[model samples]
Target: MYVINKSRHSAYLLHAHIVFVTKYRRNVLGDLHLDAFKTSAAEVCAEFDAELRECDGESDHVHLLIEYNPKVQLTKLVNSLKAVTSRRLRNQFTDLRAAYDKPVLWSRSYFVGSCGGAPLEVVAQYVRNQRG
Candidate 1:
């Protein structure tokens, strides 16, 4: 007789692709060092126990697709990411503050979407192609 194992359930995963834009669409993130900023953002994601799938953006906005555990709070994660990135960017690049034309690195609002049961590779590709 063969027995079935009903308790072997797959873990619940939540993939979130978030976009944080500068206030008033200012081009504070210069093209010369955009890659570095993306790297910093990825690091922040890792620190929060999230998989940084992809990070990309123009001078005015950033797009990040991250895979996080279901137990984490979405709002808390976003806020921490924004705070850390903003502080790091300001300290590393002084010109960013001057070019910001505002007191904030990221706008007060953000865009977040939940991707459930979708292949992570597909979501990563979409984020990577957001520049186009």
Candidate 2:
């Protein structure tokens, strides 16, 4: 999963483990909404030239292991994902909108950790193994 991406001047393999929590700790995320969310999130990743390596979630939060090139801005990618996914989910899923009195889907804070330390493929395998 750690295929190297080459630009005109460089080749790189960068991965980020990101977690997004729902606003107000509400149990708004469920099996009913996961597919749409995952699809929308994958499109968002594609928009930034990133790959959605893996995804999993609970009732209120979601975990994503993403692989992207160095050219992409991590903060911009994260923000767009939060905003676009939040807006799309709320618009598509009535239950999620009803779960929140406010219009926000995701909370203001998020978690992102850089992946390194052994090798890129090894880290990818470790993350893939984590799904179970």
Candidate 3:
């Protein structure tokens, strides 16, 4: 079972499945390439007191199943993850920027879905299967 660190004031537990696309929706992340980025994203999530259960994606977008403390603002967590991963991926893989034809690595918008009451295993499986 997945656990989230909760305090007295915050009883809510959040399991989020988030997705962000590459700039202009370019297909830059192949299998091997995305594995490295997923590894880095997991590290970033862990630093923020979140657990990255699964990280996967196609060429254009990334999908993450994350469990975080309710006290932490959701928007803040998403912003931090996106910013850190984008910067790191851009630096490590210059080809990503070039393929997308932009100085940035990811697009501005993202998709975040909330899971509550459902089994974590079920949610995680759904997130792993997301495409496009």
Clashes of each: 0, 0, 0
Predicted candidate 3 versus true structure: per-residue lDDT over 39-59, tens digit per residue: 888888887888888889898
List where candidate 1 sits over 4 angstroms from the true fold.
1-10, 100-103, 116-132
State each model's CA lDDT, in order.
0.78, 0.88, 0.80
Q: After aligning candidate 2 to the native by TM-score, how far in Å is the CA of 100 from where it should be?
A: 1.5
Evaluate model 1: give its TM-score: 0.74
Candidate 2 lDDT score at position 105: 89
* Model 2 accuracy (lDDT, Cα): 0.88
lDDT winner, 1 or 2:
2
**What is the lDDT for 76 in model 1?**
88
User: Which residue pairs overlap in candidate 1's backbone?
Assistant: none
Q: Any runs in candidate 3 off by more than 4 Å, and if so which?
A: 3-12, 119-132
| TM-score of structure candidate 2 | 0.85
Which tens-of-lDDT digit does each residue in 1-132 have in candidate 1? 212213245455567899999878887676654677677777877777777778888888988888886556889889988888888787778787776656568889999998656478987999999999
Model 2: colliding residue pairs: none
Predictions ranked by TM-score, top down? 2, 3, 1
Candidate scoring better on lDDT of 1 and 3: 3
